[model samples]
Target: MLEGPEIHRALTRIAHEVLERTKGAEDVTLLGIPSRGAPLARRLAERIERVESRTVPCGALDITMYRDDLHLAPARALGRTEIPPEGIDGRVVVLVDDVLFSGRTVRAALDALNDLGRPRSVQLAVLVDRGHRELPIRADYVGKNLPTSLRESVTVLLEESDGVDAVLIGPKRERGEDRTDEARTASGEEN
Candidate 1:
């Protein structure tokens, strides 16, 4: 699992990689998935600005309404979507997220983005890419390539919300299993 310093380093590296991949961040919009990614997007934009001296557009996008598993998944609060003033049309939009698991979220994000506008190009950037992607989607820029089991869950605790920065990985209990206990960080010791 990733710690505070680790997460910071990853984002710094990711920001540089994004600029390199997009060729100087021109017409680029960093659209982050709701919750964790929104803050991460702002951090990435700041890092990019340090190098380029020009600010890159940042926005928050929520895919709850566009998800395909609504019928099966539990109901949750819908998140707000805020697009940048520049919009996504004719720009390079990089979708940012904390973790990549089954890739369903990215799929939903793609749909949500399509409804917003047709970007000249879209790319993906994630802090962690845990294997077992149910969809064919893959991240273009990844901070870390983490491997996790289907029975395990990866929760990214950002300082913005959790008050501490760390990645928690633990057994994912089913409906009948006990869910009272807390999860632990993997720390890349025992995946």
Candidate 2:
């Protein structure tokens, strides 16, 4: 798990990279892909503002409807998206997310952005860029490059929810490893 100082360091590095690549955040807007990304985007925006002395608009996007696996979960709550008062037109947009694994979330974010407005360019920024992409999407600014297997899940717990900001890599349990126990639990069986 990453400590607060480590997370701050990574965000600082990413901010510098973004500023260097985009030549500053003069005409840039930070758009976070809902939930976790929203806070991350806000944090990055602050870093950019302090470094460049320019305020960049930070917005949250809800792409649940655009997800490829929409049917897997129950209905998702929509988030408020406040693009700069000027909107995303002709601006350099940086999409922020926690972990980049399968690239499906990024894909969904792109689809959602299309309805908002056409930006000058869109770049991705993520904390962890774990290998095992189901699509071709890649992050422009990555905090850490963690090579992981397909059966592992990287979870980011924020201070707001988990009372701490940390990254954890959880290995998925193998199939049939505890089927009997799982079934018993489901059936309300005692130990």
The best candidate in terms of TM-score: 1
Per-model tally of clashing residue pairs: 2, 0
Can you write out model 2's per-residue Cα lDDT over 1-191, one digit (the tens) per residue? 57788888999999999999998777889998656788889999999999988888989887767877657544445656667687999999999988887788888889988998999999999988877777989999999887777667566766754577888777765433443423211111100
lDDT tens digits, residue span 78-183, model 1 = 6558899999999999999888887888899999999999999999998888888889999999989988778787778878867898877777655323212221
What lDDT does each candidate get?
0.80, 0.77
Could you tell me which 10 consecutive residues in candidate 1 have the lowest summed lDDT?
Answer: 182-191
10 residues in a row with least lDDT, candidate 2 = 182-191
**Model 1 collision count:** 2
Candidate 2, residue 130: Cα displacement in angstroms equals 1.1
